[model samples]
Target: MVASLSGWLQLRHTSRQLHSRLAPFSTSHASPSPSSSSLPQSTPSPSQSQEKERGAFSKLLLFLPGAITFGLGTWQLFRRQEKIEMLDYRRQRLEMEPVTCTRNNMASSESLEFRRIVCEGDFDEKKSVFVGPRSRSISGVTENGYYVITPLIPRETAPDGVQTPVLVNRGWVPRGWRDKVVSGEEDLDKPSTSSVASNTGDEKTASWWNVWSKKPTSPKAKEIVVPPPVKVVGVIRGSEKPSMFVPPNDPDSGQWFFVDVPMIARACGLPENSIYAEEIEDEHTAGAKNPYPIPKDVNTLIRYSVMPQDHLNYTATWYTLSAAVTFMAVKRIKTKKVRL
Candidate 1:
């Protein structure tokens, strides 16, 4: 009985010792440590909050480009339709009959633009001007050339009996021909000729044969012969507005880059209101030497200057880019939301 009591006492003492050792541990866990209490909670910092806001704003900004591109695509579609309608209207106008141009009737030339007109006139070749260096495709071959613009004195007189002159874009000429015509070298090769009675001449001999058979004349006799007056059939064209990239015309040096009607008229000693016309060749006429000063076909002149296909391509490109960007923006927004 004594041994059993001693063993119980030992067990009781051990339990007390264990409780004393664990008491401090339990209290330590119950109260937070100073370091942990002083530290901040896991809430977002100011910079982090600002970053989240900026992310959302950036995502919204991404949509701006998409919306703008989509709108541009729609605008291009409208542009395409407008181009189609314009081309159709021009085509219809091209099919109309030729109209006789007179000073009284040509006062409103803008309305008559692209319309075929007949003008009886004599060419003032001395005042001819060259506009270049333009390019044209001939039989699938591109050729660099210049346009020959001449003043045409109309046969019909104004109400005050004044002979009004109009500007005529005769056609494209070879680049080399410009210097020849400008320097008067073309007239130097001509032979001096005397007028002969047609009845006295041999029937088989042409009048041109006699002129060419004679010896070349002196430099003083190399004057340009004025051509006889004749009826001119051509299309009326408006003056061109030069783009920023085009070089300005140097009228003093006689270098013309583009056809500015007022400037060209003043340079050629014609009235400011002179009408501009492009001479078209008859379908049955033989091709001229040097394959130029050839006039473009009427159908070609009336066709679209800028093709609608280009706008269609632009529309497709912009819309596709918009869809891609929008999809990316939406995906990014969803990902951000999920993360949040």
Candidate 2:
């Protein structure tokens, strides 16, 4: 009985000792303190903290701009496409229409007509006018030049007796013919201070309107200068401007080659009331030199038969930019974050 009691006492003592040893470890795991529950705090030095803050600011600066730009660009892309499509549709509609100039006529049969009408007329070389000289953007250059204007006299007199052949802007000209010496009653050879003044019987093929004369003059479409008038098939568009300068007796080689109708009428001793048209294709006439001259069709241009492509392209770009800005603003609102 004594041995049994001793053994029992010894076992109890061992159990107590084991429990005492494990108490601290068990308490630490079971009931951690508030501070201990959180992650360890790592405080930077003052200098390090300032450097980190600057780094964060720099990142924000870089990231914000990029994010804004990306958002804006995406918005613009969609809007740009939409506007482009709309213009494309409008351009197509215009081309299908006929060219007509009526006062305040928006969608008239003659408003956007690219072609399909047969203008029965003949080139009035006598009244042919070299219209305003201007620039056309080819490639990236603003090429120096001008267009020749010649009103075609209707073969079949109009009900109102108006010639109505329309103004024809022949082509472009270099900036060399601005002086009176170059443009005289007659100077066939290249512009010169000392050269023979030969009065070539020709006028259209004359020294004036160098560009048009460069290539053979488009022949006057007429089997017999009577009956069967010349036919011009092309689009009817708007006019640029009128020349105001007096028609010099002989403009200088450096003088402008623009036959503004209102201006030219005053000079030609005729009434200012006139119409204008450009010929893309001309019918072959017996009186014409090189009877069948190849036609130059400008319809290949993107905005052909209607508005110009450059203007349309610029408009698209603007709309795209506007859309992009709006989109960026929307995105900024959505992604805005607050500092805690």
* Error of model 1, residue 118, in angstroms: 0.7
Candidate 2: tens digits of C-alpha lDDT, residues 54-171: 8677555644554555555555566556657866764675367443333233234344433433355555545434433565566798866445455555544543222343554444
Please list the C-alpha lDDT of all candidates, in the order they appear: 0.77, 0.49
Model 1, range 172-205, lDDT digits (tens) per residue?
8877777787777873111233453344445334
RMSD of each: 7.7, 16.0
Clashing pairs in 1: 172-293
What TM-score does model 2 achieve against the real structure? 0.38
Residue 277 CA error for candidate 2 (Å)?
3.8
Q: Cα deviation of 322 in candidate 1 (Å)?
A: 3.6
Span of ten consecutive residues with least summed lDDT in model 2? 188-197
